[model samples]
Target: MADEAQQGQLVNDRYRLVRALGSGGMGRVWKAHDVQLDTHVAVKELLLPSGFSAPDRADLLERALREARSAARLRAHPNVVTVHDVTLVGGVPWIVMELVSGSTLQERLRVEHRLPVEEVAEVASALLRALGAAHAEGIVHRDVKPANVMLTEDGRILLADFGIALNEADDGLTGTGVVIGSMPYLSPERARGEKGGAPSDLFSLGTTLYEAVEGVSPFKRETKVGSQYAVAHASVPPPRHAGRLEPLIKGLMERDPDARLTVAGALELLAPAKPAPPPPVSPPPAFSPPAPEPPEPEPRPASAPGIRAAAAAPSESRPSTTRPAPARAASAGARIRAGGRTRRVPAPPPRRPLRGLVLFAAGAVLIAGGSYAAYQWTRTQYFVGVNDGHVAVFRGINQELGGTPLWEVETDHPEIELRYLPVYQRKQVEATITADGPDDARARAAQLALQASACAKNAGENGEDSVLTEEERLLTDRCGN
Candidate 1:
C-alpha cells in the first residue's frame, strides 16, 4: 500500500494525488484533486504495517472509517474540518476531507515557541466551539493536540484529525484497559482506563491551550509512561505567562471531571464583558442663583427743633430715636443712630490658627511614604524584554521613572538576538512580557532562546545567509538542535 501511494496516482478513478501533505504512524495525508468536484481536497490514506495481525488491521480500518463519519456529522460547523467522502481501495480506507491551507499549531509553536495570551484565548475559543458541536452529536475528540489544530491562512481555526474520536453510536473498538490518546494530554479518567466523554475532550483542549501560552505541556515528562503517570497524578504547574487566561485554563484542566468547567461555563469565561452598560448617564444639574445681599438701612433725616418741637421733644425724651426694623437684616455693616449721629459698625477680628503647620507636616510625611511604597512595589514585578538586540530579564515594573526605565536587567541572554525572533514576538519583547517573578522571567528568556535557535535554523534552510555568531552557535548547541 505504501509503494502504491505515489505522486499523480488516481484513487477511485476520481481523486488524483498531487502531493503528500504529511504522514503519521497509522496513515498519510495527501493533497489531491477531486475530478467531479473540480477542487483540491486532502485524502487520508490508511497505511497499516505488514507486521500487524488481522485484528490490529481491522481495528485500524474501523478507526479510519469512524474518523470520516465523525467529521462528516459536524460538516456544518465552521470550526470542524469538513469531510467530503470515504472510499475503500485495495481493502484500505481512504478518507477525503477539505484541504485547509495553513500550518498546524504544532508547526507554529516550533517557530514562535509561544503565542500571546490573547491569541491563545482566541484559539481556545474556536476549538471550544468545535468541541461543543462535536459533543452535541455525542462525539468526543480523544486525540486533541497541537498537531491536530489547524490555523488556516484565512483567519480560521479548524480542529482536524478526529481519527481517535469516540462516537456513542458506534461500538467501542479498543479493548478494555487500553488507553488511546496523546500521553501528555490524556485526561486522568482516560489514563485510568475509563470511558471519557465531554470532560475528557475539554481536558485535552485545556492542555493544548496551556502549551500554546507556556511553550511546554503541563504534564509532559521524559518518557511516555512518566508522562501518563503525571497526567493522572501530578498537579498542574502554575502558568506564569497566561495572564487573564489563567483562570479559564485552570478551570478547564481540573483533575476531577465533575469539578472541571462545562462547555457553557468555559464559553461564559471567554465571552467579552458587556461594555459596563455605558455608566448610566445622569441628567445635568439644575441651575439656582445665589441669594442677593440684603439692602443697607436708609439714613434718617434730622428734624429742626423749633419747626417740629412737639415731635422732637417726645422722641428726645426716650434719650434716643430708633427706626423700624426691615424685613431682611443687612449682612454687611449696620448703621446705628445715637446722640443724633450715624456711625458705621466695625468688622470682627480674624479667627485663631487651627494647627495648620502640624497638618501640613503630616501630609508631607504621607506623600513621602507613598512614593517609597510605590518604588518598593516596582521591585517585586518582573518582565522579559529586549536589552539592546538580545533577550534579557528585568526586575521591576515595565514602566519608567520620569524618562528613565524603572526596570533593571536581572539576566542577559546575549546569544539570543532579537532580530531572530518573529516580528510579533519582537514587538512583544520590546513592549515587555510580564512574569510572575525572577524565576519566571528567566524561564521566559529560555523559551526565547529556543525560538531564536529555530529562527536561525529556518534562515539557514532558506538560504538566507544568516550566519550565526559564536554566541548563537553556542545557543543552538544548548537547545540541542
Candidate 2:
C-alpha cells in the first residue's frame, strides 16, 4: 500500500485526490476534490493486475469506461449513486462521482444478523425504487447485493457499485462461461450462464432482502457445490420474525421469478398505512356569541336601465344561519340518581401454577445426570487407584491429561483426590474399589493405611497411543465441534 498523500498526488491536473477509499479486483476508489468545481467526489481508477495480457487490459479498460458512462445516466434519480465524469490519467481509466458518507449494507447485515419485517420492507422499497428508475432507462444492474447498497447514517438508502452494470445499447462484453457477480446473490438464470435482465436483478435483490429478513439467504450452503445446487432449485425459507409482514417477505423471496412481486408492486405491499389513534373522550366547551344584525338593504334606482342593473346585482337578503344550541346541564339531584347505578369493576382471576416448566426442568436434570453417571462408570474400567493422589493402571499408561474432575463429596475442590483401587492377587488383577472424600491429606493417609494390608502383584498389560489419524482429524473438522 502507498501513503495517502502519495496516492492522492496520482490524480490528473484537473482533479486533486484526498484519500484512497477502497480497492477491488479491477480498480481503486479515492475521495478527491474536483479542482475545477471545488467539490468532493469519488474517483474510481481502473487497474488491471499484471496477470492480465495487454489485450485483456485494453478490453477491461474499455468495458469499465463504457459502464461508468452508462451509470452516469442514472444520476437523475435520487436513490441511484450519481456518476459525474470519466477520464484517463496516464492511460489508466478513472470515474469521478459524488462521495457518499455511509457504510455498505453488507457491513450492516453482518452486524445485525437480520432486520425486522417493517425494516426489511422499508429498505426493500428504497432499493426497488432505485431499481425501477434504472430499469426505466434500460439499464440493468448485473450485480445487486448488500455490498453495493450504501446505508447512510441518517437512514437514506443508495444503490451503488455500478461497475458490472450493462447498457441495453452496448454489445456483450463478458466472455462466455465466465459467471460474474457474487455466487450467493446470483439469479438462477445467471448461474446457468444466461444474460441477466431486470427480473434477474430483482431476483438478486430478493435474495439480498431475504437474507436481511431471514438471517440467511435461501440459496446459501456450507459448500460451493451445495450453494450451486440450491440456486438451481431450492426455495428460500420465510423470515423467522412473526410480525405482520412475514407473508410479504415470503412473497418477495419466492423461488420463481414470475411469482415474485415486481419492484413497483413490492413498493405498494411494503408501504402500509399506520393505524390512526383513538380520539380523546372529553369535548371542548361550546361558546355562544351574539350574531351580527343583518345588513341594511340598498335603495333601488327608479329607471329601466337601473331596473336591469338591479336584476343583475347579487342578492341583498341576509342568509339565514343556524348554530348548534347549548344543551341544558343536569341538576345535582339528577347526577346523584345516575351515580347510584354505576357498574363495579371486576377483580382479576387467581394465578395458576406453572406445572409445565417444573416438569420439563425435572426431566432435563434426570437425563443430564444419568448421562454423566454412565460416562463416569465407563471410564473406571482401565485405571485403578494406587494411592489417594494417583491411579494405578497397567505397567504402562497414556492420557491426554486435558483436566482433572473436581471432588463433589465435600465441596467441589480440585485439591480433593478421588481414586479407584485395584485389589491384586497372585499373578492376577482382581476387583476395584472407588473412593472420593474430603481433604487430599486425609485421603492420602487412608490410602497408605490400606496399602499396608495389601500385597504387590504382577503388573498389568502395557498401553499404546490412541491419537486420531489424519483422516479422522479431517472428518472431525468437517463435522464441526
Candidate 3:
C-alpha cells in the first residue's frame, strides 16, 4: 500500500492525493483535494502488515472504523479535529478530515526546545476543554501526546488523532494484558496494564504540558521498557522552567490517578488572577484661622507721682462693661488722670515685623528653582522600557518620588509586544535600557520592535499563531505573513 500510494491517486474517486503530509508506524496522512466538496482536505491512509492473519486484519479494520466514529462524535467541538468521512479504496480505509494548516506541538518543541509558561498555559487550557468535551461523551482519548496536538495557523489549539480513543458506548476492543499508549505519557495504571479511565488521559495531558514548558519528559528513560517502568513507579522531577504552571503540572502528573487533577481543577489553576483595584483617594480638609487672645493691661509704673492706672477704675463702672468704647478711649493714646493731673502713656510698640511672611517668600523661591532644575534634568534623561505591554521610550528614570512615577512615556510602539521579544531583549526592556537622549531611547525601542517583529514572523513560520491585538496585527503584517 505504501508503494502504491502516490500523488494524483484518487481514493474512492473522490479525494485526490496531493502530497504526503506525514507518516507513522500505523499509517500515512496526505494533503488531498475533495472533488465532490471542491475543497482541500486531509486524508489518512491506514496501513496494515502484508502478513497479518485473517482475524488480526478484521480487528485492525474495526479499530480504524472506531477511530473515525470517535472523531466524528466530537466534530462540533472547536478544540477537536473534525472528521469528514471514511472511504475504502483498494481494501484500505482512508480517513478524510478537515484540512488544518499547522504543525504538531512536537514539531514546534523540536525547534523551540520549550515554550513560555504563559503560552504553555494557553495550550493546556485548550487541551483541557477538548478533553472535557470528549469525556462528556464517555470518550477517553487514550493517546494524548505532543505529537497528537496541533497548533493551527489561526491561533487555535486542537487535539488530533483519535486512533486509540476508547468510547464507552462500544464494547472494549483492546485485548487484555495489552498497553496501548506512548510510554512516556502513559499513566501508572495504564503502564501497569490496568483498565484506565479519564484520569489516565489527564495524566497523558500533564506529561504533554510538562514537556511543552520544561523541554523534557518527566519520566522518560533511555529506552521504551525503561520508560514504561519509570511511568509505573518513578518520581517526577521538579520542573525548573514551568514558572506558575509548575503546580498544575505536578497535580496532573500525580502517581495516584484518583489524586490527579481534574479538568475543572486545572482550569481553575490556569485562570489569570485578577489584579486588585487601587485604594480610593480622599480630598483634603478645609482650613480655618485660630481665635485671637485678649490683650493684657499694662502694669502701672511703681511710685509714679499721683497717677491712677486704668485698672484702678471701679469694678461696677468699668466702662459700662460691654458698652461701646468712648471716642477718646478708642484713640491710640489714652490719658490717665490722678490727683486732678492728666498724663499720657506711650502707645504700644509698633506690631513686630511678620518674620513668618519673609521666611515663606524665601521658601517659595527655592522650591520654584528646584522644580525647574528637576524638570530640565528630566528632559535630558531617557530610557527604554515597557508601557502597558508595549515597548516604549520614557523621559525620566523608572523610579518614583512621593508615590508618583518619575518617568513619562515619550514614544510608545504599540505594534511591538514586550512578551514576544526574545528573553535577552525582554530582560533589557524590563531593566530599562538607558539612553543618552530621547532620540537614542527611541532608537533602542525601534530595535526592540524589530526583534518582536522577527519573533512573530518566526512563530508564524513555525505554525504558532499567537493571539494579537489590532496593533500587534500591524506588526505581524510588517513581517510579510
Best by lDDT: 1
Q: Which runs of model 3 end up more than 4 angstroms from their true locations?
A: 1-5, 48-57, 169-173, 176-178, 277-481
* TM-score of structure candidate 3: 0.60
Per-candidate TM equals: 0.65, 0.52, 0.60
- Ranked by lDDT, the better of candidates 2 and 3 is 3
Rank order (by lDDT, best first): 1, 3, 2
lDDT of 2 at 64: 68
lDDT of 3 by residue, 83-169 (tens): 888777777778888887666788556434566687799999999999999898788888799988988767789998776566644
Screening candidate 1 with a backbone cut-off below 3 angstroms (N, C-alpha, C), the clashing residue pairs are: none
The list of candidate 2 runs beyond 4 A from truth reads 2-6, 47-61, 90-92, 168-173, 221-226, 242-245, 273-481
**Colliding residue pairs in candidate 3:** none
Cα lDDT for residue 239, candidate 2: 60
What TM-score does prediction 1 earn? Answer: 0.65
Model 2 poorest ten-residue lDDT run: 453-462
Which pairs of residues collide in model 2?
A: 385-420
Task: Estimate, for each residue in 1-481, the C-alpha lDDT of model 2 and write its tens digit.
Answer: 5635456574768777777767755567787888888888888776654555567556756776787787888888878888888887787877877787666666545433455565667778788999998888787787788878887645578898776676655432343344556677877776766556777788888788778765677787898667767886776655655265665556655656678778777777777877999887897779889685455344455568888888679987876697858966543223212343433233345455589778989999999999688557544323223333443332112232246442222212222122212211100112222222223223433332232222111111112333444433322211100
Scored by CA lDDT, what does every candidate get? 0.79, 0.60, 0.77
Q: What does the lDDT read for residue 38 in candidate 2? A: 83
